[model samples]
Target: MDPQTVYEKLGGSSDSEFPTLHSEVARTEGETPYLRHPGVILIAKPDVDIEGLRPFLEGYGEELNFDAYLDDPTPLPPGSLLLKTAGQTCYASFGPKRTYNENAQRYFDNLSSSGHGSVFEHAVFSFFVYGVSRAITHEVVRHRAGTAFSQLSQRFVSGKVLRFVERPEYQDVPTLHKRFEQRIDFLAREYDEVAEELVELQLQGDPRLVAEARTDMRKRVQQSARSVLPNEAETTMVLSANVRAWRHMIEMRTDQHAEREIRDLYFRIFLCLRLLEPMLFGDYDIESFADGTYGATTDWRKI
Candidate 1:
């Protein structure tokens, strides 16, 4: 998720928004704020276990055999899990609780039968996402059902030159390739020079003046600097999505052609959840849209 997404997730301002609670959701109906879905959701702290997550991160780096199921419908690796959001408001206008609540109820009941349902709602995750454009943040902020986010802000910060996204097919043709690279390179170098000069001066000045110069430089440089950033330069966001919102994120972001970066991020998040909370996760599925949606088009909005 990007900063814009964060801005959007926090939706309508309120004291209630920050101290998010399940009970408050009942009052949110049409009154829900327009905040963006947080890029990363952090759960209520005391319940978390750092040790449980280590294995999930580690497993991502391991190699897997894809040849065995090359021609068939194969599921993701076992350690991978679901981040279901069948009722998220942003991705889809879940008709109402009457429809989605039943799914949630059943899913939890199934888990309860195994004696693990109570902890299901307590489930949480920190999703680290990358490679999304500011443009997409518009849609991501809508899954406000249950989650928290931390994203990169452009308002108070400036980027390190702009990096635009380039597709593989376009790069294969020299005509389009050279122009794109040159444009990106020129802006990158220009931004570095200006920001560096400003930083060096601030380092040598009095504290107050240093602050002033830093501010001035950041503003001035960003004025022209951001012009070079490409829509696809990678952005990293962290989200604290609960079991419910996870399902929603998967429904939307995990679909074909969700930005490759977000798709990759959602996949990682799904896999992580699958490992620690299997009983709660087993009911949801990610394989539904894993194949070709994104590869088929340039329209990332579909994700």
Candidate 2:
């Protein structure tokens, strides 16, 4: 096919042909609509095998006892226990004189104070983060070290039921809120119209196009049509990171000076991590700001 024919088949020849393909995706009333807040669910964490470590303890020295932790009435959470064990393994600190389960808080505090963070990497956490904006994720993915992410793909998935995230600032102001809603509704309709046009253009009785699979054709159409989607478009992602990386990100992102939307997201993540492994995250002091957002500070900033 000629270049012009191919270009027209793909969608349009130039950006001027599609002026409405700007801004964010939107949703119809019966469909899932705008989300006002982000959400996070801790879906996974480290699970240590205390009994499995017994053989390693014996090989190190008979004086090294893993049974002490196994026999204790109050056992630590798997993530905390794994961190403590990894830290103690460095010095063979497993005997009675070693910091016991009761002193786990102090042990972790020492780890943070001393900037010994390698052991913290042994405990990994996974979260299902949803209803967040693409803008926030653009920042989240920047913390690439010791972190893994599986985010929603706009290409393969249609945005017919797309949802936008309303900024906290706009949500409280009546005029801004109304205008934002109207904009989203208009964009949603625009997305549907553009997507339909693209679909029709691609499938318009061309033998080569007709030969393409239905799913492949849809992917091509939606991928181009999704350019109109804005940073405020709601996206879901699975974020997995080690304790060290999480702490570093939380400390950086939850500062009072950080962007308000992301600070709110990370503060919730910090709370979840603290609940999951208090000994590791207990040093953070969470503060609520006048803007109805939260920030976190810790004496041990990086570690």
List per-prediction Cα lDDT, in the order shown: 0.43, 0.76
Determine which window of 10 residues in candidate 2 has minimal summed lDDT: 16-25
Model 1, 78: alpha-carbon shift in Å? 18
Q: TM-scores, in order shown?
A: 0.47, 0.85
Which pairs of residues have clashing backbones in candidate 2? 24-230
The residue-by-residue lDDT of candidate 1 on 220-246, one tens digit each, is 545544555555443445667656566
Which regions of candidate 1 are displaced past 4 Å? Answer: 1-121, 155-180, 193-213, 257-261, 286-303
Residue 160 of model 1: what lDDT? 40
Q: Compared with the true structure, what per-residue lDDT tens digits does model 2 show for residues 195-278?
A: 888767776874433435778777777787898888988888889999999999998998888988898778767766765566
Sliding window of 10 residues with minimal summed lDDT for model 1: 19-28
